[model samples]
Target: MRVGIAILSYKRCDITRHTIEQVQRHTKADHELIVVDDGSPDNTQNMLEELGVAYIRGPNCGVVWNKNRAIYYLHEMRHCDVVILLEEDTFPMEDGWEQAWIDGAKRWGHVNLAPSHWPLNDRIGGTGTVSNPIISRYVTGQCCSFSREALSVVGYLDTRFRGYGHAHVEHTTRFLRAGWGGYIKSGRDHNFYLIRSPLKVTCLDKPPPVADYSKNGDVFNSIRHDHIHRWCWRDEEEMAVFHTSFSTLSRSGIPVPTISKRQWFLSDNTDQNLVWDPETQVVISTPDKKDERPRVIATVSGETVQFKVLRDQTFWMTWEQPGEALLKEKRSEAATFKLIYGKNGGVGFFYNGLFLCTDHNFNDHIVLSRPEMKNWEVFHFSGFSDLEQPNNNPMRSDRIQDWPL
Candidate 1:
């Protein structure tokens, strides 16, 4: 599929230049990259000319408007099938990132991916852990993908969410409602590498301000106030936890499976050997002869959770919660689980999966709960079949070494 990328920059010319360079080196598909300079005083125009990317120079429009403008120019004017949006500071990890997203789009019709965002130490907002196949109400524009159909239906980022907070959330909600599936990829990190020019590191002592566009009677706030019954997922008590894993079998290649219902018990007495073979792509849970078999359940594929023992002997869980089901289930699908390493992890439900409302500590063991359901039955699946290994592992050391930093 023909893909396009849009990079929005307010005044961070240096960061924009670096981001463009990284994208050029890493993008593997035939695609167009548009850089929108929102009336910056810096030498952004000169940098774009030097880089030779499709450049749009406009007045000092706010973030929402500039983003919408870029979409209009690229999608409406240039006529691309898909658009990959990025901020001036965000960078892709490798050359095949675009292909991965394109592949996802081809399979699911609509998708959005994001990097992990860890709050600075001592910051009020909890440290952010990335989710795989994220079903959030909104995704950060730092790096995301949108199918042409999605943009055509959802229109653009609501300019009323001018400052920062609720705009992306509002736009994403509309997209989800319009039958778009959101995804956050795993095994990669969108690190906060630099805050080049104009954006600098201040004291990491205080929390970032929560943008309150809701108070101004924006679309997001209107829905929040007027639609009380539709907002039943807002309650905390109605929540459940979903978990899953992705593995590759030896003869088989990479198999993404959902963990079905299974109980697991760890005895206090003996040492259990948990094996994670990258070559085999199999995670084996072989306990000493005496310990109880932890009954752990997972779905093999398609919107189910999976649980497995990682290389470090810690348990890892990931799953995709269907946006439709989340909305129907008034209860939230939120829960905390103890990591294999004993760290805490969990995602809070907001308006179903349309938005990830909060992050909670999972160190303390908590019960698994389900969100309130209206009419749909929760999807369940059997374990995955063995996968076939490819002649060459696309994820190789040489390829990794060559990727732009």
Candidate 2:
């Protein structure tokens, strides 16, 4: 098989260089290497040049877009029998990794080389000294191998998953539906190592550039608006059995107004005034020192919930008590969040049960690091009303600019 390796790279020059160096050092088989740069304005181009590797520079098209481009380049452009996709953060851990994946690809059309929990089956042992390949229901694209024939069957990776979520599952589901089996090759010494993702910095000197909150939100809502139904399984209404609605919003004879405006909401009912300042908008600035930080408090049902609207377009919920005290206290106290609905009655702030609670001190907030909203993450002011007419821009004259960041 004519094997090709395509690395989807952005920012993080150091990590990208390390990943390339590792791939070059470990792989013993003869295969072509391609690096697709997603318009990262860094030393990425120069670094790839210094390393003497094949690369293509693309616009800031996002994760899935670049991934599809990589697949296209390797499978269609290069006419390879199989293409391997790797992110700058993940790289092979052992020699002959390419050969192992190529072998696995022959058995199963798709092979995930990264170490992740088996989607459907438990980890199985290989031989007395080797690990066996385990079948997976869904596999991420991080370090996965796909054959040209499999791509022909399942089609290319959907570039519509433009940002950092669900592309793996969506693509994997397609392969599964086409009767293509996905597998995990074990018995190799840790096949891959996922290094820390580049630190987000606003400065130009930083390796990877960080997009501002609004731009990030635009990308996020774009993906969520398009593919959320598939991600949340909205077609299967029977799965939403976890929680009940708030009595006030449900029973209030307000026609359960649909999310009409895109304004941010605070839980406090007493503060009717708009919280945002037009002159110097909320820039998501953080105090240099924790001790120097001013106290942030919001009242919900007469009790104070320590909350902060971060610059990244996500809110944080925290508690002042210690770990043990935090455990003993009712989940209602810290977790009890008031509805921060938009003017259109759409939920501006909510949590996804899947990616729940990123820990910053004792705070738990939705990880807005990515663009797609998890199934539990979305809610409507009028019970899925916002979702029904997602693109609708219902105007509310009374609404004011409240999203500070």
Instruction: Please write out the lDDT profile of model 1 over residues 1-405, one tens digit for every residue.
Output: 678888888788887888888788878789977777665778887777676666665444356656775676567656778876777777765666676566545544445443445223432221222223433323444655667776666666654344556665556555555556442234221121111111112223645455444443455756532311121111111111211111211112222222212222221111222233344333233344432333222222212233443223434433234211111111123222222110111222222333211112321111123353211112211122112123363322223334221
How far residue 338's Cα lies from its native spot in candidate 1, in Å, is 58
lDDT of 2 by residue, 1-405 (tens): 699998888887888888888889888888988787775779997887777777765445467556766775677557899887887877767777677667656656766643433233333323211135543333445577777888766655443343555556656655555545432244211222111111111222434233333444454445432321122112111111101111112322322123211222221111121122223332122222232222222322211122333232434443322111121123334444433322212222322222222223322222333223333233322122222334434322222122110
- Which candidate should be chosen as best, given TM-score against the real structure? 1
Q: TM-score each candidate.
A: 0.45, 0.44
lDDT for residue 198 in candidate 2, whole number 0-100: 17
Clashing pairs in 2: 126-131, 126-132, 131-187, 259-344, 259-345, 259-346, 260-344, 261-343, 261-344, 352-377
**Candidate 2: which stretches are off by over 4 Å?**
114-132, 183-405
